[model samples]
Target: MAILSDITLYPIKSCAGIALREATLTRAGLMTEGIYDREWMVVDADGNYLTQREHPKLALVTPRIKANTLELRAPGMLRLEIPLGLPDPESAPARTVLLWDLSLKAYDCDDLTAAWFTSFLGLPCRLVRFHPEAQNLANMKWTGGVEAPTLFSDGYPVLVIGAESLRDLNERLHKAGRAPLPMNRFRPNLVVDGLGAYEEDYIDTFDFDGAVLKPVKPCPRCPMPSVDQATGTFGPDPLEILQSYRAKPEVDGGICFGMNNILLEGEGQRVHVGQQVGAELAF
Candidate 1:
């Protein structure tokens, strides 16, 4: 039986991920301690989100959950903590933030909080959280017309990959005399074990006992994967290996990694590690 082997939530996009033994699955993505994936983002003056692809230092901005605050720390930088509680709806600073063409209302974090990130990222930027009132949902056409709310994820609510998929890639990498890569390199929200390589790509619906997720899109590979999750340094790209076989001609020859998924049911449901999983193929 396939099982959920790992779950990771990125509180801040392109930064470190928080590994959770169990987390609440929401339409927006995995939620731990009530915080959704990519709930907070760092945006430049143009309101474009920043990522490790261009700013590797962004990975050093580690987040830690405290009793009442989200503590963030960077190398050689002072630690910053922002309150976990929601800001005053009427009094909080509001602004238009763009996450790849989707102009949405976002709460601009406090000046001090923004400065902390600006100093760490070495750029003029501000930290912003998903506006409590803004409605940002995933594209429904790709999701079979089911509208699902999202926080600040790139496009989809969830990304699922199987352990055997990584093993398959590593086996080739070993034969090619290249070092093996970690599963974190793929940055999947869900990692399923006990499945064959590339099994997620054909899975139309992924059922986990009580919850379900529908695979919506082929998660296109990006430079983000080339950046080492541990050191934040860029290195050998998996796309080179994937180009030989993982390229989806239907996707215009783009190499794919994980499968973008959308929540189908079981909101606020707990997804624990080791839970059995069943797959329903699309065709």
Candidate 2:
């Protein structure tokens, strides 16, 4: 039987993730404590979403939940809080922010929050929460002609990988005398155990009883994995190790770790640890 080995929710785009033993699975992604994954983002002076691609230090900005507020803490910076209350349209600071090709309105957070992020990332940026009016949808081509909503996520709602897949990679690394890697390096939203190596990439859909997810795209790896999940400091890149055999020729030689997935059914379901995952293979 397959069991959910891990659950991760990223509240802010391209920042750290929150690990959970139990979480609510919505059409968009994982939800815990009433907060949806990637529902918040940090934008530059021009209101463009900032990712760890340019500012690796963004990995250090950690978020913790507080009563009625989300507290953020970073190295060498003061603590900051973002009130969970809905913004008042009349008084809220509405600005256009770019997420890939889609431009949308995102309310600017308080100055303290902005300063904390800017100082931490060494960039002139402000924090922004997803506007209720904005529609951030994943590409329809991967959703089997259906539209699924998502927020600040790279492109999909979920990223699923199998533990045996990591074990396979680690086995190779061990033979090569390199240290074994952790699942955090891939930043998967869901990690399933008791599956064969690379089982996820071959899975057409992962149906957690009612919640269905179609793995539509091969998640292209980047330098972000080099950033240590615990220290938030970067080190040796994993691309070299993955380049040996992790390349997906189907994607024209793109290296991948996880599968980018879109929710197909069960919009507001709960996914918990030790839950069985019924997989539908693509081939």
Candidate 3:
């Protein structure tokens, strides 16, 4: 039987991820303590989104959920706390940020928060939260016309990767005289065990109790995976190793790893580690 081996919630986009024993599955992604995945993001002064692709050190910005605030810390920086309570949409400072081809309305964080990120990242950037009224939808072409919503994710609402897939890649890496990479390098929201290598690629839907998660698209890998999650630095890139066999013609020959997913049913259901999962094959 396949079981959920890991559940990771990334509160801030492209930053450190918080491992959870259990998490509430939502249409937008995993949520815990009222904080949704990728709810907060760092953006340049021009409102363009910034990620580890440009600054590997962004991974060092770690977040911890306190009672009522999200505490952030980085190397050589003092701890910064952000209130969890939703700010008044009417009164909060707002900005128009560019994420990919979309122009999104986001809540501009306070100067102190902006200063904190700027000092650590060594860039003139500001922190922005997904505005309560903002609606960012995943690609309809990939979703087969189903209107699926996401926050700051690259495209999909959730990313699912099989444990054996990594094991398969690691075995190849070992043969190539390369060190095996950790699951964090891919940063999937859900990790399933007991499946064959790349088995997730053929899965049509995952049933967690009554909740239905539909795999919609292949997640294209980028140089972001080369960034070591622990040290917040660029290490050996595994794309060359992956490109030999993992390239998918469906995504325009982009090297792929995880499967991008969207919730089809039971939005508020809680999924826990070790929970038995039922997967339906596409065939």
Which number leads on lDDT?
Answer: 3
Per-candidate TM-scores read: 0.96, 0.95, 0.99
Q: Count the backbone clashes (under 3 Å) in each candidate.
A: 0, 0, 0
- Maximum-TM-score candidate: 3
> How big is the positional error of residue 133 in model 2, measured in Å on the Cα after superposition?
1.8
Tell me the RMSD of model 3 versus the true structure: 0.6
Clashing residue pairs found in predicted model 1: none
The C-alpha lDDT values of all candidates are: 0.87, 0.85, 0.94
lDDT of 1 by residue, 1-283 (tens): 8989999989988888888899999888999887889999999977888888799777777888788898988888888898999888899888998888888899889889877887777788998999878888878778778998888888889999989999999999888888999998888999999878998989989988768999888988988878887777898987888789998875788899889999888888999998888888878
lDDT of 3 by residue, 127-155 (tens): 99999778899889989999988998888
Runs in model 2 lying further than 4 Å from the true structure: none
Write out the backbone clash pairs for model 2. Answer: none
Model 3 TM-score, all chains together: 0.99
Residues 28-82 of candidate 2: C-alpha lDDT, one tens digit per residue: 7888888989989999998888887777777788888778988887788878888
Candidate 1 lDDT score relative to the true structure: 0.87
